[model samples]
Target: MTEACERPEATAGGAADPGDPAADRLEVRAAVFRGDDGDRLRVETLALAGPSHGEVRVRVRAAGVCGSDRHVLDGEWNVPLPAIMGHEAAGVVEAVGAGVRGLGIGDHVVIAWHQACQRCGECAGGKPWACTRARSNDSLLPDGTTRWRDAGGSEAFPYLAVGAMSEAIVVPEFAAIRIDPAVPFDVASLIGCSAGTGFGAVANNAEVIAGESAVVVGSGGVGLSIIAALRLAGATPIIAVDVSEARLDEARLAGATHALLGGPDLAERVAEITDGGADAAFEAIGRVQTMAQLPELIRPGGRAVFVGLPPEGQKVEIDGLLLAYEGKTIIGSNYGGLVPARDFPRIAAAYRAGMLPLDRLISARVRLDEVNEAFEAMRRGERTRSVIVFD
Candidate 1:
């Protein structure tokens, strides 16, 4: 873990003044994605402005390399260039800006990519997961601006608002959720995105009841997380499918009752295991073919939860007639329909309690300079989750 920086005295409300020049000009090393195919991520020294109003500065300890980040690297998701491309991370608060209440310097935190505007209708209606204002693709902060700049002073965007790939970052107070210090940063980092998303999909979106049957169509980090949550939810006949035998073994370790290799006959095999079909089928891989096969893998009234994110502008062609005839529901789970402030800590607690095998999800730990290699491992289906750990 990175040592917390020297704490600056807070003002009356435990909030640091944003006008401090020293705070405004903090420099940090970050893995930058310039959107060029030849140069995916280059380690560079970047200047970061300290926490502004309703924000906090975090010294990142560990950041996970996710498939969503891979989407941007593969040119599937078009995000702003020269951005810090990471969202799943755990760190410690180094400074607090004006009006920051729930967090203070030295508090361990998990960075939430979706920093919902609490005043929005979706947030007010108790569905911050569907917040209309938190744009993950924009790469800009909630206020539509960036805190990072290059050596030549070119503004750089935080890929998904939190930008955990950097050594340090400034994010909205809501984006930094406090967690138990006992949890390891590397394990806690997966909770920020993959674990939280998977658990939320089961608890919030699918609402899988005890004895319910579920089939997870991917055994990657997020897929393994879903399998774990399904077990905790008391689901039965939990089947996991993936192309890699290694990930299938991981799925079994994460609580999959059965593991199967993904192929053209995947749906047929899942049906054979669950009698007619599973009560719920989760598509964790964002491929069109796998997503389209979800309906076939579930029972008549079963729900198909789309937990994986396909490339932007890509559409899946599900059989509308079949869906209507069978009364099957398709749910789109964004960030697993998670409310970060409420769910991140709960996930951390689960991890500490041994309810979730989060540490097993990390297949490789690399430094910031080796981020591209980690992503390549992900591309080759050789990893469950790769974390970039800072010194």
Candidate 2:
């Protein structure tokens, strides 16, 4: 008898070698969204094609439910319909396609959601994070088609090109970076996005130096990671601001020198803490008010880094004269300005060495079916990170 969850049927025009793993279709349970209905996910069986040339297939071991994933569910982001939207994940390689080297089946790997095509001008200019093709909405393979289809044969797009909320996924070989087996799948999952983004923002974007003062607004997972990175960087008087007392407590555990509840006098409180103002301030809450208030948290000639992603069309206004006369700089960081291939390993090593507190960041471990509930918990601000651990 067949199992309760039957395998997905193969798509048309696919009669290849039966013995070749790359030619076969695998059926897996995935939390899928049919559209931007903002409803809970529908657990469905999806047919996933094997990796094509320059691609690798991974059996997802752990996937993170992040704020960005919630944004996609809330229709705050412009994503293709019928999308599988989790990006932060780590797993083991199950299959490898032609022309892919240095990775083989059974290799532990972390999925870097963004895969930069080095041929792009942005990539050549040393900004792979801005690679246009890598952020495509279609989630197309290198050959310009999707590897996923629903039970009805409708195409299923992978969000951010790495829909990791599934039992397995097929991604570009470059998107799957080999990781140490010593790093647990759950810990490695955070390093893929949250850890990398937060650490990169401090180390690369803000460039906060030792003895410098920094304030991180919003004490979510990314915010806590920013706090941890600030401490590692030896930034003095690291201040964390958040509305939730529980999150503020987490911030303190993550090495925040001072934690303050956000209110009307937040700016004044930060000023008093730093004896003037911060050398740099990071806005991890994606809100117009938070983004607008960042410039006021930093002193003259200081930098304000906006690490959160506000919805499109939402605008924030700052004093142009104050920005110009004070010589303050406001910049946006994508993926914490990280080069995943080079940075993921460093982050994993940091976790292994006990320098970065990966264990503290994980608030809950869940199953794939609890993903929607996990997102709700995130919306309620109850978890720093809720990881879906697959068996």
Candidate 3:
């Protein structure tokens, strides 16, 4: 954790201020970068706008480091840059904008990266993640703009429309999913993206059945989360494949009955474990080739899910002759098929019921100032989920 602020503790008394003036600022500091390849996020200060109509000002409590951020940094997911770069987060609603209903100041909430415009056709069609309005030239209203700025006059794009790397941020009311108060912000943070996507892949996408065999490749944060959800859902013979033994340990904790050392025969190992092929297979590393191989690991009529964010222009080739005869299906999972407002609370309730081990997946808790070290740990694959917590 960074030395600048104390670790956030659970409060019994009325929530008290931490006394850090930066905690309340339109002008603030954040890990930022410029250019489409928004890699190498640097610390900077900027003046950001506050909440406006149907928005809220959030004091970011904790934010999990997600692979999509890596994609943004690597320029694979071409996010507009000279921007703040975090999306998976949880926090308190410090201020609610005009017309915001059903939530109030001081509410604990998970910030959904997907900001759906309810009126948009995509949102009307049950695909909020595909909200075309999210990509509009003016995605942020003055209230939706970042809550930080530098001495120079320029705008900073927040990744997935809600960069939570900073001390505070301004987001849409729809982005703030009120969670069970019992859920810690750190655990709730993973619900924002990590748990949402991983678990959603199972519950919403694959709908894995009890006692079914499952495989999750590239067992990082998202992959491990899928494993956790499947375990809770009663999937058996769960196999986790990763190049790193340490992550494999994390996967075991998350609920993988078996961890296979990544190699040429990974698909074979999964097939062998399931006695033919897995009932379902998930690819989370976002490598086109790896994603393409997922179908081969599943049996005929089995389901294959891709959870990774592959780079632009990437393509994966497959053995069509075999797949055509197998009657296999390939599915692209977006945000784990999460319906934010509904799923966040359900996940939180599941956690409070002791049915979910969200804390086990958490590797570390650092203040916003330690954002750089968290990413470094991510680069080395040293952590399952490193959360950046605010005071």
Among these predictions, the greatest TM-score belongs to 1
Sort all candidates by TM-score, best to worst.
1, 2, 3
lDDT of 1 at 128: 84
Instruction: Please write out the lDDT profile of model 2 over residues 167-239, one tens digit for every residue.
Output: 9998887788888799999989988888889999999999989999999999988999899889888998999
Q: Point to the candidate with the largest lDDT.
A: 1
Better of 2 and 3 by TM-score: 2
- CA deviation > 4 Å runs, candidate 1: 1-23, 37-39
TM-score-wise, the better of 1 and 2 is 1
> How far off is model 3, as Cα RMSD?
6.6
Give candidate 2 misplaced runs (Cα > 4 Å): 1-22, 135-137
lDDT, residue 225, candidate 2? 88
lDDT of 3 by residue, 93-130 (tens): 87655555656777898988877677878888777877
* Local accuracy of candidate 1 as per-residue lDDT tens digits, 43-131: 89999987777788889999999988888888888888888889998998887776666677788999888777789899988788788
TM values, all candidates: 0.94, 0.93, 0.89
